[model samples]
Target: MLKLYDNEKIVLIIHKHWFVMARTIATFAALVFIPPVILTFLPLATEQFDIRIVEPATNFFLSLYIMVLFIFLFLLWMDYYLDMWIITTSRIIDAEQHGLFNREISEIPLQHVQDVTIEIKGFIETFLKFGRIRIQTAGEREFTINFVPHLYEAKEVIIKYAHEAQKTQLPVTSN
Candidate 1:
């Protein structure tokens, strides 16, 4: 469960573009079929070698290959599913998962946000409406989210709440 500050509400939970996940699946699917396709030429191999040993060895190796591929596919799915950004009324929470054990989370308060920039490049990115959003903060540091779908809408939400958060900043104290 996500812990929130008092009176804070979540505005958005953003994931990588659906196309990214789709492409991952497509690539893995193609890889998964490679062993079977190669096995279709099994008779040629059997003619050169003993059928019993070669067939079982091929089955064993192919099974291992497929098992390894599925594990990799699961890892990709975990990376896709776990890497996310949470936009709240008070802050933007960037949580990126790298592999199984490594994760990094950063928070940028909307009040400190200096700018939000959007970049959409290439025909695919432009047509698919997926791109990158870079957040510039008052501290001069930047945080970037890539393969972000609906980037324009995300920018608007961040800008809108950033303006609101800026309005609520503590007033300057007189010396």
Candidate 2:
């Protein structure tokens, strides 16, 4: 849950699809099983090397490797899970987690939004119904939300909000 401004209500919280996390998940799964596979071949290596020293060293290194892998995967998951685009009734908030220590959060008022572009490129992205949404603001600042699911719907929502905000900001003239 993220903190919101006074009177601001969240319209949508968009995150990258599960498909985007698949590669990292698959790689982590593969690495988790690799140690055992390599251990199976340890006996062959023991014929040339001393078992007493090799066994303890191998065990220590493998344990350290697994610990490192777990930390790496956890960080990767955090990066994916923490990064999000929050669209509220009044504005859009972009929160990006570069690493455990580095994070950036920016917000753009709905009235500042000038254009919303949705790009569904490549066969996989089109087939999966996930793509990139770029919101161009009045000051030429572009906020890009990548690998977002239901991109068109998100774009439509943003456009609707922007129009609403623009209408409210317009001055009423007498006939």
Each model's lDDT comes to 0.90, 0.88
Number of the top candidate by lDDT? 1
Q: Write the per-residue lDDT of candidate 2 for residues 40-90, one digit (tens) a residue.
A: 998886888888999999999999999999899888989999999999877
lDDT of 2: 0.88
Cα misplacement distance, residue 151 of candidate 2 (Å): 0.9
TM-score of each: 0.89, 0.86
In terms of lDDT, the poorest run of 10 residues in model 1 is 166-175
Q: What is the C-alpha lDDT profile of model 1 across 20-113, one tens digit per residue?
A: 9999899998898898788998877679798889989999999999899889999999999999999998889999999988999988889999
Top TM-score model:
1
Residue pairs of candidate 1 with colliding backbone atoms? none
